[model samples]
Target: MRRIAMVTLAAGVLITTFSLTTTPADAAVGFWRTVGLSGVDAFGFYDTQAAKVTLTFDLKDTKKDGYSAALRFTFTGTKKQKDDVRVVALTGDRLQDKWQTVTSTRLKHMYVQECRGTWKKSKFTIKKCGAWRRHY
Candidate 1:
């Protein structure tokens, strides 16, 4: 009985260790849009392993004519126990209806970050923004 218990405990420990090591880092996703305007919408996501940001913008209400939207991503993280950051900018044109792009960067230490997205349109003067915080 003692030997059997020891073997079972050892097996459990090995399984747990393997599971932890094999687990994939969590991906962060967020959404944003112009507050008063329903026509412009955007989605953004962060991949922990790839350390990339993907942004997609849609010109939902196509009733009007040509318009252009600009998106900016602000990322904040820590590296070497100190502050680190990276910023990327992407633009989407309404003529095509939808636009998406991805950019690569180091997400810093702790696998945690705060990302904020700001969006504006050519015809629309005021800028709109949204934020998401991800932890792993």
Candidate 2:
């Protein structure tokens, strides 16, 4: 009786451990909303087939200051194939493009004294007034 009870307990523990480490089927969805002094822009849609992101930049009044260029981009990072999840980071010239882990803190903390930048590609444009973060 004692041995049978111990075996049942061990099986239960194994099952519980497996369940706890398992991520949900849709756990990799990525979404984000951007807030700046110019206004608020939201972008992203759920995709369970793969991890994807839709981005929107509003250049509404920025053109008059010689920086008016708005863009909407939808891009999916390269998946590992074995896993359906994808991850991307903004670096190099793309650093000014959007909020990455390092750049976001500077923007959010109001450390930008003077921003001198230009958009080389529509996909990489900077918002002077606010910070952006991943919604997911």
Candidate 3:
């Protein structure tokens, strides 16, 4: 009986140790806009193993609206300060489907916003923007 109890305790301890050490699955957050003549869909995920953020965008406009799709990413660093802000605009073929990966060790949280923009003189200007969403 004593030997059986010892074996069972050892097995339990080993299982617990393995479970605790195993890496966690990636986490994701997303938003979409399909009500207007144009549409935009996006998802953001945190890759645990890679220690990075991956953002995917899908833009559609069957009506051929002049406006373009855009995504803005605001990353907060470990010091609780805004570290980086980036804006990506997609037009024509590039607007259909796109994905971007951000690798930054200092990134602690991310704020995302979707917007519609117009191009003029080789510059993209945001005309409308949606509410900001946050992910950590």
- Highest lDDT, which number? 3
Mind giving the per-residue lDDT tens digits that candidate 3 earns over 23-136? 666544444333332445655455423455554444443334777777777777667554788878776534366665655444467677777777887788988887777665
Evaluate all candidate structures by whole-model CA lDDT and list the values in order. 0.43, 0.34, 0.63
TM-scores vs. true structure, each candidate: 0.36, 0.28, 0.59
Query: Runs in model 1 with CA error above 4 Å?
Result: 1-39, 50-67, 79-95, 108-136
lDDT, residue 10, model 1 = 100
Candidates 1 and 3, the one with greater lDDT: 3
**Candidate 3 at residue 119, lDDT?**
84
Better of 1 and 2 by TM-score: 1
Number of clashes in every candidate structure? Answer: 0, 3, 0
Cα lDDT tens digits for candidate 2, 1-136: 9999999999999999999987677444343443453322323333233233222222223223434323222222334322222123232332133432211111101111112223555444455533323333
Residue pairs in steric clash, candidate 3?
none
What TM-score does candidate 2 reach?
0.28
Maximum-TM-score candidate: 3
Cα distance off (Å), candidate 2, residue 114 = 16
